[model samples]
Target: MDYTAQILKNPIFKIVGEAADEMQVETYVIGGFVRDILLKRPSKDIDFVCVGSGIALAKTVASRLGNARVNVFKNFGTAMISYKDWELEFVGARRESYRKESRKPIVEDGTLEDDQNRRDFTINALAIGLSKHNFGKLIDSFDGLKDLKRKTLRTPLDPDVTFSDDPLRMMRAIRFATQLHFDIEPDTFDGIVKNADRIKIVSKERIADELNKIILADKPSYGFKLLFHSGLLKLIFPEMVDLHGVDIIDGKGHKDNFYHTLQVLDNTADRSKYLWLRWAAILHDIAKPATKRFDKKAGWTFHGHEDKGARMVPKIFRKLKLPLNDKMDYVQKLVRLHLRPIALVKENITDTAIRRLLFEAGDDIEDLMKLCKADVTSKNDVKVKKYLSNFKKVEKKMREVEEKDRVRNFQPPITGDEIIEAFNLRPGRVIGEIKEEIKEAILEGKIRNDKQEAWNYMLEVAQKKGVELN
Candidate 1:
């Protein structure tokens, strides 16, 4: 199919073609840009593959565009140019063969067909001609177009050879299936299962990248289910796999925490797109297995699972090579406080309790409520309704407390400096004690969250402590 009209709509393609013609090398738009255009997905990055030096073509195109700047990677034989909002990458059409120990491939200049054969998936092997003779022709040597139409993910070559050479493709396969909502062709999926162990050779960062893409997809659980069944989850993340299974004692059993976590993940996805919050949902009950116990009276109990799960978050993040920054902290805090709202729902919803929760959750109170609401996964309609109604009451109480006390992320009206100056004392336990008391008083509604009330309370505490005023 000729995409001349489509190519003409964007003047950048014509400029690229003109540059390729001047360089006297065959060039084409290939990989994701071509695939996404056919799928009608919005894509900002475009890749060009040329028969000769792609770096030279990039320089030529950049020079022609005048204002565009080209960044060349000498080691990788590739170049990049950012024009307006679009990032264009240029690479030589080359074939690759990988060593057994590494996913890195040995590259050599080759024909377009050779380049296409090296692609990880057939759908990605589709290319659009950019030469003068065939300015917009579609090239599909591996029936990639047919597979694209059928929404199937298959390798351009033997699945075993493809996966063995580069194990990261295994993760990519699952990621694509999740993101595109496409089916992995049976053989390709079988290849992933057969070579699941090979994924250990892949770097944690790359695996994390693919996992993040899967999590960011509209239906993340689908990808995770595939990972679990295909044996990849066990190899990459055994902690999660440990959450599977139901143990029965005297015909009493607990729900499968693995599937339960997935349900929570999906529920969270339906309400919010924040990746870390979804991560918090996945890990909210991660320590249930560790904390699980059974009694004849209670059947089963996962006591302190929330606290244990919160402690496990940092270790898991370190293992996964995820950022050890505030994102990880957010997940940890959510995991630690996940059951707090439910506790409030179960018992009396009081202003004091609401103020404490608001102070702890701070600006993330809304997100925490979202997670707590999603945590309700009961199949019983009446039970679910009752829990939801109770949650609404908890939410109402939270809002009232927040508006009245302004305690969400609230700082004590009395500072340590003020306490030190007033008591004429050095920085010590006394100052911290005073601050804590003031914060506690505000949260407990004993004193208003105002400077005057806090100063008066501080004076009373100081007098009781027998500290001399300055």
Candidate 2:
């Protein structure tokens, strides 16, 4: 198939073809750019493969494009140049062989066919000719166009050979399926399950990169479900897999926290696209297995799972090599407070409770509420409706309380320093007690969240503590 018209339209392609001809080397646009164009997906990055030195081709192209700087990686035999918003990378076509213990390949320069054969998936093996002789002809030996038409992810070569050579491709296959909403060909999927254990050879950073792509997809639950079925989730994230089973006792069985968590994640995805919030949903019930207890009255209870789950976030993030900063903290905070909104819905929903929750949740109050709302996934539609209605009411109350109290990210009206200065006392337990009392008084509406009311409360507490105020 000739797509010469498309390639010729781009000014950079003309320069690439002219440069390749001058150098007497063959060049073609290969891999993702070609596949994405055929699939009608927008891609700004293009890959160019040459039978000769890719670095030399990149330099020549860069020179022809008015001395555009070429960034070369000699070790990988690849080079890149940035033109406007597009990134073009050039690499020498090569064949690869991998050992049993490692995913790193022994690379050697070869023909274009060798490079296409080394591609992880058929859809990514398509190449568009960039030579003047047959510019725009698509060379697709693996029937990648057919796979694209079928909306399937299939390996170009033998499934086991392809995946075992570089186990990270297994994760990429699933990730691409989730991103494009494409199906993994049956044999390829089976190969993934069989070689799931090989994923350990890949680095955590690379694994996390693929996992993040999956998490950011439209329906993240779909990717996670695929991971679970392929046995990859158990190895990569045992904590999530731990929430899988349900134990029965006395003819009463609790809902599978695993599936329930996925439902919440999907619900969160529907409402918002914040990656950390989605992570909070995935982890909100993560400690259910550890906290699972059976009582005579409460057949099965996961007491303090939220708290335990919250504590587990840092460790999990560390293990996965995810960011250990505020993003991790955000997930942790949401997990700890996910149950608080539900508790308020069941109880009297007092101003004091709402104020505390608002203060603790701070800027994430809205996200926390969204998560709590998504948590209402009962088979009973009426119960779900009731919970949703109550949540709306709670949300209204929260806004009112937030406006009245100004308690979100609220700082104490009376700082500990003020208490110490007012009471003529040093920094000690007595000052902390007074500050706590003042803060409690403000939150409980015993006094207004104002300086005068807080000062008076401070005096009262000091007086009760037998401390004289200046």
Candidate 3:
């Protein structure tokens, strides 16, 4: 099909065409940009594959664009240029062969068809010609347009060869399916399962990157489910795989934490787009397997799982090469406190409890609430309704307490220096004790969170401790 009208609209295409003609080489805009255009997904980055030296084509294109700076990667036969908020990447068309032990391909310059054949999926193999003779004519040797119409993902070449060459493609396959809400072809899906172990040859950072993309999808559970079925999760993230399965004793059983976790993840994804929050959902009950217990009275108890799960977050992040900074800490805090708000909703909702929660969660209070709401995954409709109603009440109370107490990220009105002055004491344990008492009194509603009340309370505490102020 001719997309010449569409291609001509972008001035860069003309520049690229002229550059290719000048260099006496054929070039085409290929891969993701073409795939997204067919799927009606907006994309800004374009990939250009040239039958000759891609670096040369890039240099010519850059010079034609008034010497726009081009970043060249000689080792990869690739170059990139940024123009008009669009990133255009150029690569030489190449064929690849892989060894059994590794996923790295032996690359050699080839024709445009060879490059298309090397693509991971049919949809991604679509290309738009940039030659003056066939400007904007689509090159689809693998019927990528048909796959786009059917909402299916299939490798451009044989599935085994495709996945074996680069095991990361398995992850990419699942990610694409999740992002587009499409189905993997049955043969391709089976191929992923057979080649699941090949993923271990890939780097953890690359695996985590793909996992993050899958988590960001509209219904992320789809990707996780595929990963689980394909055995990739067991290889890459066994802790998550450990969450699978249900056990029974004396005809008593508990819900599968794995499925429940996925439900929570999907629920969170629907409500919020924050990556860390979705991670919190994924890890909210991660320690259930480790902490699982069964008693005659209680069929199953994952008591303290939240705390254990929180402790597990950092190790998991380090292993996956995820950021070990505040992002990890944020996910850890959410995992630890995930059950607190829900417990309050179930019990007597108190202002003091709300104040403490608000104070602890601080700026993340809203996200924590969103996570708690998403955690409501009862199969019983009536129970779900009851839980939601109670949550609404708890939320309303939290708001009221937050407004009155202003305790979120709140600091004690009485400072350590103020305590030392009021109690006629030096910087010692006595001053710290007084400060703690005053802060607790305010949080517990025994005294107003104001300087006057705190000062009076401080004096009372000192007097009780037999420390008279001069």
Candidate 4:
């Protein structure tokens, strides 16, 4: 089928075709942009493959398009041009053969068919002709259009060969399935299962990238289930895989932390698009396996799982090559405090408790509440309703307290520096002790989280301490 009209709608398409014709290189728009076009998904990144020097074609195209700058990568024989909203990448069509030791391929100039053959999946191999004579003509030598119609993903060549050549393809298979909400062809998925260990040859950064895409899906659990069954999760993340099974003792069993984690992840994803919040859900109960114990009287208990899970975050992030900065910290904080609000539900709630939650949670109180609420993945509707209702009350109390006390992320109005000046004392443990006392007083509702009140309270405490102003 020809999409000539669609091709003509964007002037950049015509410019690219004319530039390719002038350079005398056969060119076609291929890979994701083509697939997304057919899927009616909006894409601003376009990959164009040409038979000859793609750099020359890109330079010519850029020159015609307001003398735009073309960024050329001589090592890869590729060029990129940013044209308005679209990022245009041009690469020469080439065939590749992989070495056993590495996923990097040996490249040689080849025809369009060769380039299409190298594509990871059938849907991604679809291409559209860009030259004047064959403008917008669809190319689907591997039945990519058929797979698209079936809403299934399959390897363009032999599935084993496709995945073995580039183990990252295994992760991409699951990522695509999750992102597109499509199914993997049975044979193709089996290939993933068989070649799952080969994913170790791929870098952690690449695997983490694909994992993040899966986590961001509308339903992340689907991707995780695929990863688990394929055995890829074990190879890539055994810590998470360890959460798989329920252990039984004395005729009692705990929930499968693996599937429970996935449920919470999906629940969090449904509420917000924040990737780290979903990650918080994943790790919130990660240490349950390590902390699991049977009390016989009280059934199964995962004591200190939250604290252990919070400690586990840095190692997991480091192993996965995830950012070790504030994003990791955010996930860690949420994991540690996930049960705090729920703990409040069963106990007698007080201003001190609310103030502590508000103070510890700070700006993330709402996100923490969301993760905690998502934590209640119960089969019983009444149980779920009760948990959610209690969470709502906790949220209400937090809001009211925040408005009244202005204590979300609030520091004690008294500062150590001020205390040092007030008492004419050196910076030491005494100052640290005083600051803690002030913060504690505010959090305990003895003071109103106000400067004057904290100052008055600090003076009283300092007087009791027998500190002399020098």
Candidate 5:
């Protein structure tokens, strides 16, 4: 199929074509740009490969445009030019060979066919000629159009060689499948399983980047299951793998936390597009394996797993190379409080309970509720209905309590400094005690969230503590 009409509409391609003609070199719009054009996916980044000096061609193009800036990476022999909202990358056609110890490829200038042969997947190997003589011509040496039509993922070369050369491609394979909702060709999948161990050589940061992409897919669970089955998950993220399997003692078996976590992830994905909230769902029950216990009456118990999981979030983020900023703290807080809303659902919830949840969860209370609701993955339809109905009630109660108390992310009406000044005391444990008491009084609904009432309560507490109140 000809994409000439569609591509010609964009003046950038014509400018590049003119620049290539001036340089008297063969150039083609290749890789993801070609793939996405055929798939009708919106793409802003454009890649072009030429048989001549890509750096020199980039400089010519930038000079011709007169407005775009060329960013050159001399080490990699690639240059990029930004035009409007689009990024155009130029690279000389080159062949690559890898050593067993690293994925960094030894590069040597070669023909366009050699460059296409080195592509990670067939679908990405398609190219569109960008010269006056062959402008808009489709070049598909590996029948990439067929794979695109079949919605299949396969390497242009041997899958074993492709994955072994760069095991990160295994993650890329699954990531592409997940993003495009395609299936990995069986042989390609087998390569992933065989070379799963090679993923260890890749940096944790790279693995984390791929994992985040998978997590952001339309149905993240599909990618995760593929990761688990391919054994890649075991090598890259053993903590999640440990959540697999079910152990039974005396006819009692808890649900597989691994699959359950995936379900929660999908559920959260459906509710919100926030990546960190989805992360919270994945880690909500992470400590189940560590906290697992059996009792004759209780059947199975994961006591304090939420607390343990919260504490584990930072360590896991540090290991996985995820951002340890507010995003990590957000995930940790959700993991810790995931059970609080459910507890309210299962019991006779009070305003005090809702207030504490709001205060602790702060502005994240909505996300926490979404996580708790997703956690209710029961096979019994009736049980699921009951839990959902109870959750609605809890939500209603939270709204009412929030409207009246205004306790979400609320600071105590009385400050520690005020308490110290009133009591004529230095910074001491007594000041902190008074602040806690004031916050508790507001949360417990024993006093209005007003400065006068809080000041009076502070004085009363000091009197009770046998300190003279000014």
Candidate 6:
């Protein structure tokens, strides 16, 4: 098929074709750039495969395009050019062979067909010609266009061989399936299941990168289900795997936390496109397995799951090689407070409770509310409606409380320095105690979060503590 019109729209393809003609090497635009073009998805990264030296082709193209900087990787026989907003990568058509012990491939220059054979999936193997004679002619030897139209993910070659060559393809398969809303061909999916253990050879950084893409997809639950069924989830994240199954004790059963968590993740994805909020949904009930217990009367209970799950966030982040930063802390905080708003549903919600939640969640209160709402994965429409309705009331109370008390991210109106100086005392436990009392009062709605109110309350407490003013 000719994509000449579409290919010609980008001036770079012409420059590359001219450069390839000058260098007398066959060059073509291949891989994701072509796939996305046909799918009508926007893409800025373009990969070019040439029969000869890709670095030389890149340099020739760069020189013609006002001599843009060409970053060359000698060992990999590849080069990259940054022109305007586009990233143009040049690589020689090469075939790869991997050893059993590592994912790093043994590489040697080959033809365009050899390069296509090495691609992870059929849709990605599609290429468009950029040479003078064959300009815009597609080279789809694997029927990738048919697979794309069918919304099916399939390996270019034998699924086993394609996966065994590089196990990271397993994650990429699921990631692409999730991103494109496609299904993995049965054989291709079975290949992932068969070679699931091979994923261990891939580094955590690459795995985490793929996982993040899946999480940020329109529906992350699908990718996670694929991962769980393929047995990759257990290998990469055993703790989450432990959340699976229903433990029935004497006709009492708890929900399947693993699937519930997936629902929460999907719910959060619909509400917000933020990654960390989705992470919060994933970990909110992580400790349920650890904290699970049963009583004859009360049935199953994960009593301290929230608090325990909060502590598990850092450890999970470390194990997954995720950044141990404020992002992790944000997820942890949401996990800890997920149940607070729900608890308010059963009773007359108070302004003091709202104040405390606002103070603790700070600017993340909205995100926390989102995670909490997503946590409602009940199949019972009535129950879900009741819980969500109560949340709206809670949010309304929070706004009223915040406007009245100004308590979000609450700061102490009375400083410890003021207390110590007023009491004519040095820095000691008494100063800290005095400050704590004032903070508690502000959060409890006993004080207005006002300087004068806090000052008056501080003096009254100091007098009661038998600490006379100087």
Q: What is the C-alpha lDDT of each candidate?
A: 0.92, 0.90, 0.90, 0.91, 0.92, 0.93
Give the TM-scores of the predictions, in the order they appear.
Answer: 0.98, 0.95, 0.94, 0.98, 0.97, 0.97
- Mark the regions of model 3 whose C-alpha exceeds 4 Å error after superposition: 2-4, 417-431, 462-470
Q: Which digits, one per residue and each the tens of the lDDT, describe model 4 over residues 1-470?
A: 44536754788888999988988889999999988888888999999999998898999998999899999999999999988899999999999999977999999999999999999999999888889888888889999889999999999899999999999999999999999999999999999999888898898999999999999999999999999999999999999999998788877988888988999998899889999999999899999989988897999999999999999999999999999999999999999999999989854689899999888888898899889888889999999999998888888888898889988978768888899899999889998888899889888888788889888888888888998654
lDDT of 5 by residue, 1-470 (tens): 35656965799989999999999999999998878877899999999999999999999999989857899999999999988899999999999999999999999999999999999999999998889999988999999989999999999999999999999999999999999999999999999999999998999999999999999999999999999999999988899999999999998898989999999999999999999999999999999999998999989999999999999999999999999999999999999999888888856788999899999999999898888888888889999999989999998998999889889879888887777778788898888888999899999999988889988998898998987765
lDDT of 1 at 341: 90
lDDT of 2 by residue, 1-470 (tens): 44536545788887898899999888999888887776677889999999999999999999888899899899999999999999999999898999999999999999999999999999899887788886878789999989999999999999999999999999999999999999999999999999999999999999999998998898988899999999999999999999898898988899988899989998999999898999999999999999999997879998898999899999999999999999999999999999998888855778999988988899999999999999999989999999998888889999999888899988899888888787778788988788888888878889888888788778888888899977
| Model 6 lDDT-worst window of ten | 1-10
Q: What is the Cα-based TM-score of model 5?
A: 0.97
Each model's Cα RMSD: 1.3, 1.8, 2.0, 1.2, 1.3, 1.5
Kindly list the per-residue Cα lDDT of model 3 for residues 361-465, writing each as its tens digit: 888988998899899999899988988888888888988997788788788898888767765677888888888898789889898788888888888998899
Task: Report the Cα lDDT for residue 428, model 6.
Answer: 95
- For model 4, the superposed segments whose C-alpha errors exceed 4 Å read 2-4
Clashing pairs in 1: none
Predict model 5's lDDT versus the native: 0.92
Kindly list the per-residue Cα lDDT of model 6 for residues 1-470, writing each as its tens digit: 44547755888898999999998999999999899988889999999999999999999999999989999999999999999999999999998998999989999989999999999999999988889999978889999999999999999999999898899999999999999999999999999999999999899989999999999999999999999999999999999899999999999999999999999999999999998998999999999999999999999999989999999999999999999999999999999999998887756777877888899999999999999899888889999999899999888888888888998978899888888789999999989999999999988878888999999999999999999988
Of candidates 6 and 3, the better by lDDT: 6
- Residue pairs in collision within model 2: none
